[model samples]
Target: MLSRRRFLKTAAASTLCLTAAPAILRAKNLNSRLQIAGIGCDGKGWSDIQEMSTHGMTDLVAFCDVDLARTEMVHSLSPSAPIFQDYRELFAKQGDKIDAVTISTPDHMHAIIAIEAMQRGKHVYCQKPLTHSVREARQLSNLATKSGVITRMGNQIHSHAVYRNAAKALQTGMIGKVKQVQSWCQSTGHGKSGFIDRPKTNAPIPKSLNWDLWLGVAPERPYGLQDVYHPFGWRDWQDFGNGALGDFGCHILDPVYTGLKITAAPISISAKSTGMNDEVWPAQMTVHYVLPGNDFTTDGNLEITWMDGGLRPSLQGTHIPPGTALPSSGSLVIGETGTLVIPHYAPHVLYPSPDAKANVEKFVAEPSLNHYHGWVDGCLSGQQPSDGFDYGGRLTEAVLLGNIAVRFPGQKLEWNADQLKVTNLEAANKWLSRDYRSGWKLPETV
Candidate 1:
């Protein structure tokens, strides 16, 4: 076993090598294995850790989770890997031992953890949307560029054959230049916890969980119950999550951005909701965005509409064969030649039988790549993958901007991406970033 002093020296040298050149050359190391840590040890985090472990070049080094009880699964996988309830402690003790981290924490903590990791020269594979706010997304993108570290967001479908094929089809102009798009999901914004407001009763925090750490960055609130705020229920809260648009937009709109090559942020945004209160997101909503057109677009700008809570676009003008139904969650792209339907994580379909058949014959499918292993490979080789923070931050910025629109229903908010603010509404600018609690504030510098 390598001594602590020698490990630190070697890790520092490896990190320097990674920053000095492109990742095509492998990092200097004891072996080919890339040391990795897993934060948030259950739910999506467990799956992420499990998949990454399958990569022969990756080695699990440590684990961290706010809830200790939820960490049994990971502990069972790597008995010798020490577990910590706080990520900061994990970094303090094992920073030199880790080469990369897989962050699958709640939405609010993603930016805070990812930024710190990158600043320390650690590669990151974070879950999407990359951050809770637009400003955080932009900050992450800028930091990733300056730090020169491998980074990838955990929208795994981006590597799947269906989405890869869809992106290629759109780029190849299989349906001609895109005119408009309609994307939606059947999920509601505030039902995960089955409460629209904070529960009147305060339940005792679990003995194995660190309540304070679980509420990191988010405003302090009473622990409602087991399924209220922790263990997959935070998605329904405004303080910790971004609601349906934030949950599904990064996923369903991924092909739209990839295929159309949309790098610029939306110019304007507006929204309407069924109803809402200060406590949680609205149950249903629709958001509209106007963005600058790229090479794959037909006109000056492309309009995209997003809906959730079972709301969908009217298929009146679409080329669908009259009585066909749209997917429960997916996107419909209207192009000059015909229409394309991209179902979430499923095969994409083209409208008009003749056009569909002709396009299908010419289309060659792209093979699915292992998203987890791809990040592991990138870390060892110093090569950043396609969904890295640079791309994910831009994609996440657009997704989170829709949430800002949700706050001001029926009002159009003009955006200036360069300024990272809403030009028309001064009040709306505050939503671009959030106020972190004391002691949990993000570093002002990279």
Candidate 2:
């Protein structure tokens, strides 16, 4: 699997060539069309440009958003793109008319606008808890594998079909090994709980809001009044969101790390929450993680956990059926031979006992995927979409290292993930990453 000229001659003899690699991975033109662009266009960025322009092969043109009145319904639907308010001036004045970009903003300007639009090779499509720490989700998943572009992380329910039938029923064993998973989400984000500090009144910024480009790399605050933090309640704040398990742990643990490929690096992590303060996040939480397992998990170890405000998980002994409940934000798994569940985006049941339930119904009747046209057909086939960004940036840096174990609640933390570090504290390796707004930095390569 290392062939890309032996991963650039073994990353040019180690130090991973200092990082931001891709100087060229561009491709597009597979019959012309592409040219898209649209970063933070409006709520969920105009619902991800109305699902990436319903796959008409793109051509949305351009449209950034630092809130020109939230670009009024994506300028009444594309209306000749060109809306800019700074996505670094939409790539310093339309970087060659863009070929890909989606970004949905606000998670602290997702790794500096996807590391400056994948170092101009373009093709991004970020969203979800893609970044906003955990070292910008491990440097935008190693700069989307050193900028080969064609990335995707808007965990749009990882292409719903209830998570491709719970990632094809736990990678085909139809839920057999999977040591223990459990998830949740029912509250926080409207159920309330985040903002606990910093908003000692500043207000007055709104005149169509641009409050310092919505506090770009954070660290500068002021506007706090429409239920604290900017428009979408800034997820609930903590330098602009990462709460609610980094706002829905990469969408309910993306089928427990894409049906258990898990990509290692979680020797531990812990939490218990409902306490944090220095500026929000913690109404109810739980976390946990563990990982380090493989062949679909069992004795090798795997755990997981999570939870959110409504805080659930122990349905007494399991079976269910008597009115079957437990969902608000789902994912259960369990498995030795059966459990499953799912619920969040719906349908995935399977119990096998209490008078039979099963009903997974084949990856939810197949033919579904359109998560923003699967990143516009993976940018015209350079491929890499099922939540790409090197597998959704290692499930968003292990769900933002469970928000640094909810800032030391029970204090487990360990991780290492090939030196992305945090090896047992040093103040949990200073929450992985921060410090951007002193005239903003990023760009150590991309």
Candidate 3:
């Protein structure tokens, strides 16, 4: 078996030649199955693995997770596949056999694992937000382009009929030239872990868990009781996850980005929050983004407002009728002619009742494609999907930038995307990326 250092060196060398052709093209049979591995094998990870397994052209060869107790489901699905506590071990041992990897690990570990896998010419299907840091998102996208491999972000709803239709409607001028957008989710930033601060008492680590492995890139901290920092609780912490905006922004803002063709980075970002501490995110926050306008948007910078923690956009200007209620989580596209309300996972609605309703049928609704199967198909055919890292990275960058704005509540930080710098606040720029723990440091990127 290769040592971790040697594995990285080998992977780096392979990346140099990988740009010439995709790894999938090496299969003698063009129709041969893809040998796959699951880096995280429970919760959303299990669902992703289960769905990909049903694709018929993908085979699970290995499983890796920090906690052995949480891997029961993946083991039952692939009884013969070997399981490893550390993802590096699986990569080092089965590097040659694995054709692709599904990274359902916490937001913190996503970039490191995906970068290593892609460097080895392995396709990656990583969960959103694509990386914990904006810099990581940009670097990961650059590497994905350089490596020439199939890639997809695990924002599964991107394939849903509702979002597809919403995006199509905007492009088709159903709501002529969107003037502004308001998007929000009900999820809070720090409530999932049920703690506003780190636990004062340290609990003994479970034998089934590798606490060191679980902490991956974040600074070292003691393992607390169940649900404190393990399993599903990391979403509340600053180090391990991206809080509410990081968690749901990609899903909620996907259609807006797709519809507006927002390729340029936001020119400025300002935010306000209930409050925040060093360890956890605020419970409620609001961010404003000014992005360059496109053909789908009105001239001048297009404004987007984001809110969370039960904050909903006002319907006064949306023309949705005064008594009509908004969805708990969704976006409203304010346009010159009409407003489109897109509920998360539900059908979209248009305002100005009768007239807009008539045009709904004129807008084509795309058929919902199986997201997992789409990634597998992309791997086999070497055709990059619509939500590949290129698009995902840009979306994730904007989402994470909103989180950075959360730190300085009322300041409007001027963003220079080319330099990845916050021109107005040098201190804010520091939050763009983080200092990785000593042993988990990744190679420097441009």
Cα lDDT tens digits for candidate 2, 232-294: 777777787786787788888887788777877678889877687677777788888888788
For residues 71-101, what per-residue lDDT tens digits would candidate 1 score against the true structure? Answer: 7888777878877767776777787788889
| Model 3 / residue 131 / CA error / Å | 0.4
Clashes of each: 2, 0, 0
Best by lDDT: 3
**Candidate 3 residue pairs that clash:** none
| For model 3, the run of ten residues with the poorest summed lDDT | 13-22
**Per-model TM values vs. the true structure:** 0.92, 0.35, 0.92
lDDT of 1 at 109: 97
lDDT of 3 by residue, 1-446 (tens): 32456334333332121222124222221238988999898899999999999988888988887877677898888887877777776777787788899999999999888887877778999999999999999999998887788999999999999999889888888878888999999999987988999999988887677788889889999998888889988999999998899999999999999988889999999999999999998999999999999889888999999999899888877757888989999999999888899998898898853455336555656999899999999998888889999999999999999999988988999999999999989999889999999777664333
Q: Which regions of candidate 1 deviate over 4 angstroms?
A: 1-31, 353-358
